[model samples]
Target: MSQITRIKGSHRAASLVIAGSAVTTSGLVATAEDAVDIRAQTRSVLSQAEALFSRAGLRKSDITRVQIWLADMADFPAMNEIYDAWVDPEHAPVRACVGAALANKHYLIEIQVYGYQPD
Candidate 1:
């Protein structure tokens, strides 16, 4: 049987963990309740991803792949700039970036990662 785990945060949705893989659902923007910037939002998502991996007892080098969805294609370059520095250059994971209208218009990007936690 596959074990499932979830983590809820203010800006991001529940991150689901099945076996060794972590799947982050789309994180929607907060309306009147909270205020955050575009770059901050992107950083939050990355932070959430990192936390998920940590909770699973894995390291950044364990990540095998990642999928990034952006509300606007124009944000791709900016997102990539941060992502490149965020990951280890020697063991970067395979990734795909796509343009899509996210849950809320305020949200600029959402990233989901797949990692391996060796037994």
Candidate 2:
């Protein structure tokens, strides 16, 4: 069996977990400064996800799935605009976006990423 590795952050939960060839990240939120703008919040969240992927030795292309949560449905289009530009069209991962209340009112968006590490 492959050992599970966890990368922890200052928060109570692990930031990223790696088991076998799979890598998963905890929900990533936008910075306080970007929280007011959907586009900026989306960009901030994705950038944080990218940083986590890099730590796991994975890239955006390696992502297999993505889960996104928006504080308001009205922000969907704005979020997609940034997401569309950041994701590789040829390697786009399966994704789901939905409107829901975030942990913090200031967080306009949150993103979770899942990917596979190549052998």
Candidate 3:
């Protein structure tokens, strides 16, 4: 059986979880002061995901899937602008985006990703 490793979060949720080669991150939102803007929020979320990926021994190219949640669909293009710049175009992951009411009113976007941490 593969060992499971959890990192950085409260009892309610783990920021990152790794089970064998499969790595997953909890839904991540922007924590920056400019987080109210979709562009800034997306950048912050992706940065957070990147940090967790590094901790799990993964890279942008190792990402297999991406899930994004937006407070408003209108922000999609703005979020994509940042996302497109950050993602590994050579190994772009399967992705899905949808509009949802976020936990925080100030949050404009949230992102979660699944990746492979090869042995």
What would the TM-scores of all predictions be?
A: 0.75, 0.95, 0.95
lDDT of each: 0.68, 0.90, 0.90
Could you tell me which 10 consecutive residues in candidate 2 have the lowest summed lDDT?
Answer: 30-39
Candidate 2 residues lying further than 4 Å off, grouped into runs, are: none
lDDT (tens digit, per residue) of candidate 1 on 43-86: 67777677667776777888888888888888777777777779
Report residue 47 deviation for candidate 2 (angstroms). Answer: 0.5
Clashing residue pairs for model 3? none
The clash count for each model shown is 0, 0, 0
What's the TM for model 2? Answer: 0.95
Query: Model 1 Cα displacement at 34 (Å)?
Result: 9.0
lDDT of 3 by residue, 1-119 (tens): 99999997778999999988899999998885867688888889999999999887688888999999999999888888999999888999999999999998999988899998877
User: Lowest summed-lDDT stretch of 10 residues in model 3?
Assistant: 32-41
Candidate 1 whole-model C-alpha lDDT, 0 to 1: 0.68
